[model samples]
Target chain A: MDVDTDVTSGGGTARPWPIVDINPEALAALESYKKRDPSKVVVRFKAVGNAPIMKQNFYKITASNRFQAVIQFLRKELGWKAGDPLVPHTPPRFASPQLVLNKPQFTYINLAFSPAPDDTVSNLFKSFCTDGHLIVNYSTTAAWG
Target chain B: MSQYGTTRGPPQAAKDRTTDYHTALFRRLSWEGTVPLEIRVDPNELPANSDRGLACYFVQAPRVSYLPLLMPEIRRFLMDVVFDEAASKSLKEEDWWFEIDDGTLLKWHWPIGLIYDNHTILTTIRPGPSLATTSTTPLRLILHLASPPTDKLLLAANAEACKQAFMGQLKEADFIRWGNTKRMTGLRKADQDGLWEGIKEHNFEEYWRVASKVTPTTTANRPQSPGPPPSSVSMHGRPPSADTSAPPERDGAYNVRSVPVRLYLPDGPVIQDLVPPLLEDGSPHTLAHFLNTHAPLLFPPQPPAPPPSRTNPNPRPPSHQELAYPLVQGILAPLDSEMAWLGACLAGADGWVNVCVGISRK
Candidate 1:
């Protein structure tokens, strides 16, 4: 269950809890929300309840400059290699666009904007979680990692 | 083998084969164009039939192979125009397959098969079609049978001699210079014909390995670029994540597991590279971690379990007709009333089949 909270893209606000399962439709809306304020990256968040979740936290990467970090994260933290498909992912969304500490179900996160937009589907990226909602890493602008 | 009549059409010469090959129910889909399929960026990641982006230039389908039988006119045209320009000066300039693409900048040494038993000249030119579209298109190529001629020399001991000759040719062969063609070629297997014959099939790496076999590796190494600092490489069970450099979360939870995979009945050498590659220290690549990233796409839904029912009907009585032996009767008589005893003797039908019997003196 998604709840949309209208938060301005500023440094003050903490990110919302992210949704694990992301739908293309939600990506469109989140993309629109992000476009609402171009200066700052727009992130989506929600709290989750007792749903069986594989233990892992997911993050949406931005900032092409920090692409090296993202690569290191995959290779070092996640451990990927060349010739591998990109990770599978479920960019998240909320039923209501409002702020709430508690969500009915557990959530995963998507960047609203994917760094790798190739149409090829792979088992590479997966939905994960973080303490906060709307996972946004301003560290890098998206480019070939 | 029969000699080809200079008239050139396959006509009666290939009739029997046409019927046999076409009769096959499932026509094996073959990439008829020229360029290799699955061009790999990293040659090391080859051997298995998987890739990241795409290395298959697929830039364009090369010049038509000019099948002598399929399109005799085109073959004649090209022969007069390209292979034998001096002979056909009267042919129309437009009829010649001129620079539909660009001209070969220069010739280079390329390793070829029996096709170039004679020295072959090649050039570097982008195939014409690629300039417009990158997508692969369907085309057909047929291998003509080299019929035997009556005038050829006959030697009873030519078998081994012929083999040696072929091997001798390979021993002296050079490189397979890329000519002016391109196309994506998926792994393909062949039929009774040797075009893709005992050579296995169109496995990109299989082709590479086969090539590696023919092209001996020497002590000579390619000039090294004191290349950029090497990135520490890792392995993965699945495709690697696109963004690897992201900062690690101070507090995050996840699980990774490894399961033994079995290729129970591989039809061919397709699974040669199924095993994920290992790193220097013998650890998997980073991509392995991301393998479990997607649930639905990667792992399909499991099948439903069978229904549960607990009941045992009486066993069918054994046919006790002509049991002349008491031992047979002793074995058969307890048929119905001895289930409990049989249960003790048996493993209870849970699919275990074994028993232990010991005789003791009282």
Candidate 2:
């Protein structure tokens, strides 16, 4: 008999793998995940300053998706590759030595803060969405202070 | 509270002074907090004849600082211990990254304390003669000087790259707090330089001088009158048609738009939500409210079940177990701590409250 053969192949004494039941309490805890809305959120993109505008501004993305997805989507639509440096519109006074050295693409929400890449779409939609859409502003240059 | 009134010139000023005193004390503690680290080199990166024991280096890293800041000293120490001049010359700061025991690549951009807390689970060991009773264990990290996992981790090429990233985070936090980056953008070039210099030099006074302007200290500096709610701030950085006359109040008392909070969840992506400082009814929101709102599964609204009762003797654990603890500046802050107060005093050098959720094994 091959040692690698199934346990049940030759011996009547072979026993089935032990089956352990999961805690019902732990199962009930998953109700929170079940309660969350799995619907897609509408993200509307608007160009600021010298940034190019997309033909179709509205997109429906999974609510659980990160804001980074929106950024990558915008980058794809705008034909800008990742790590490509854009001309910064930094004012003389605002420009520091480090700003010139490392320049990443700028994307803003509500013309306000740039959400981190890891921020969830649902959180942004819940907090900042207006008119049933989360408005995202993108710029190749530093659009606003 | 009455005793303070008796000793001071004016009650309001005295209160402000007391608050300031406390804020300074807390801020100093946060700045000076350090994490004990045991760093080891990747065996592949070391010479074949190198002694494993000699390769390990131990240091107390400041919580507020970044790994890249201490890279030079760590590299120098390693050179003196294991490598020859030729081998050490090949080692560069830009080519380094750190890994935990479980092969998790640490993000260099985050503060040292955050990285440690997020990765390490702290269990309180019972006090005994032979064993230490400290709750914390030394964070063990493996340093790689070869290929970096660029896909997972951002490149902190050099000190300059780290500085740029830090400035970027400051602007992000400023925008979140004020709905605009004016506080950061309006900073003079010297003050901007000072912020980075202060952290490098570990000068509390120097850092706060520049940082205080960027962060809102009291209600006085926050927006007093609630003009158009943040929802009205239009997409183009302009107010909507209805509230065109009065632009959002850029500065006022108790007017913090949102608290820049980064919640680090174990086995999940970081959650950065737009957390308003005050509720609609002008009440301060607490850490408990914030966590309950964002992470209901981990921090359920229901209170923990009572201990074993007399009749029951042994009660089943709660259905929704509170599985994690929120740690800020290496301490479990009271859940009732006000968001505004926490934002002002306990934020990291990047101007964000980095709350690391340490998951319990039990």
Candidate 3:
């Protein structure tokens, strides 16, 4: 029933495959690993709902930049027209639509209203995002109250 | 002909007609998704011993269709009870459709159909017809219990008129201005009276005046820059390998960035002695990954000591310190993200913030 027993028992010495040892090579690499550039943070956007995905959804943004940077990028990609008299067909768009907070199992909390335009992406990301990249759901209309 | 000279009591048939109308209205609502809410009309408002004191109604029907059904009912009730025949007829022929708020904001508008659903409404106004109009006070409206079989109008105000009165003052623009603000968590229907009681007790004007202001950016656009060009380094679910062959991975490298964070022990012994001063990383490290890789440095498991040494027969019991490592839990707290960066977490503090690392309690 245990197929692994044959190969493992063939050798008189039966031990786990990974017999790790202390090596100086691993230690010498620590210095470079500790350092971080801090100037830029990468953003990977994934579309949710009926929102269209960008051709290139990945981009590096300055960590200090505000969340509006992402909003602005999304508006441009979607070809949304602002309230302009000349653009009569275009509807007036709210500067901030609902940005929902999502984690794997946690309830989908509506980041309703606040996290003002001035709030930095890095701060929001550190406060809410998961993994290295932030995943946000963008919609033309408010998804939740 | 009904009342020639003396004031005759309202016709007996009038009472029966009112009952018929109410019965029909309720039967229609039973089929709709929304539950018909009941409002206990004041005892004084109704005629002597009348059973029609309570008003049962719903807000599911849109203003366009609702006005036709509603306006006639109000007009008839006024003529029969409060007004004389001529006085009720002379009342202005105004449009009731325009009376309802047509706000595009989340709080002001709900899609029609599900008349009974757990809906959360947020607004900055007080809960009555008379709105407290001050530029600063934040208002919220929470309508809950849609799919969940909960009481209708579960909060303090249950009347259809009361809900509409709250909606009347909310402008769409005000919501757009406040939507991105991170300060207010607002009230919810599920939050038993405590949240409502707190809100009700506070004077909106006085609250705003006394509260320390954390300035909100009402209007501002993001600074424009040509966004980053596409890079070949795609981290599509695979672990990132160190750039060993290329130039040494240094602080100045394009991809390397540090999110410094402060960490501490909530219950375990002071961590400085147990772990290294700094942990090495290139890719982002989740709390689980960070602890797993550094297990040897942080919490090395002790092998059972070879029985009693012949030299010393008297064996001391293993100290409490030598016990197996307790299961550790990490928290970003306040900011409860799974993979929060060390640098971003530290950015607010002088250099780093003290995050606790302790045995998982729950």
Candidate with best lDDT: 2
How do the residues B1-362 of candidate 2 rate in per-residue lDDT, one tens digit apiece? 22221111223431242335556677888999998888999888885555567888888888888888888888888788788777777767677889885687887677788877666422211111100113345777899887787756754456776776678778878867766678888989899989989878878889888987887664223322344433323322433453354343333213466788877665445667777776654455678898888767667676566688899888765675445567888788777777777787788988889876654322
Query: Which run of 10 residues does model 1 chain B get worst, by summed lDDT?
Result: B263-272
TM-score of chain A of each: 0.18, 0.61, 0.47
Report how far residue B322 has shifted in candidate 2, in Å: 6.2
Q: Output the lDDT of residue B308, model 3.
A: 80
Off by over 4 Å in 1: A1-145, B1-77, B80-299, B307-362
Instruction: Tell how far residue B123 is off in model 3, in angstroms.
Output: 34
RMSD of each: 31.4, 11.4, 29.3
> A53-115, model 2: which lDDT tens digit per residue?
555789998988777788878776555332244545522321133332233378788786566
Per candidate, native contacts kept equal 0.00, 0.16, 0.01
Superposition TM-score, candidate 2 onto the true structure = 0.71
What lDDT is reached at residue B47 by model 3? 33
Off by over 4 Å in 3: A1-38, A80-114, B1-197, B203-362
Model 2 chain B worst lDDT run, 10 consecutive residues = B124-133
- Tens digits of per-residue lDDT for model 1, A20-48: 22233323322332232122222332223
Query: For residues B104-158, what per-residue lDDT tens digits would candidate 1 score against the true structure?
Result: 1111111111011111101101112211122232221121112212111111112
How do the predictions measure up, each by TM-score? 0.16, 0.71, 0.22
lDDT ranking, high to low: 2, 3, 1
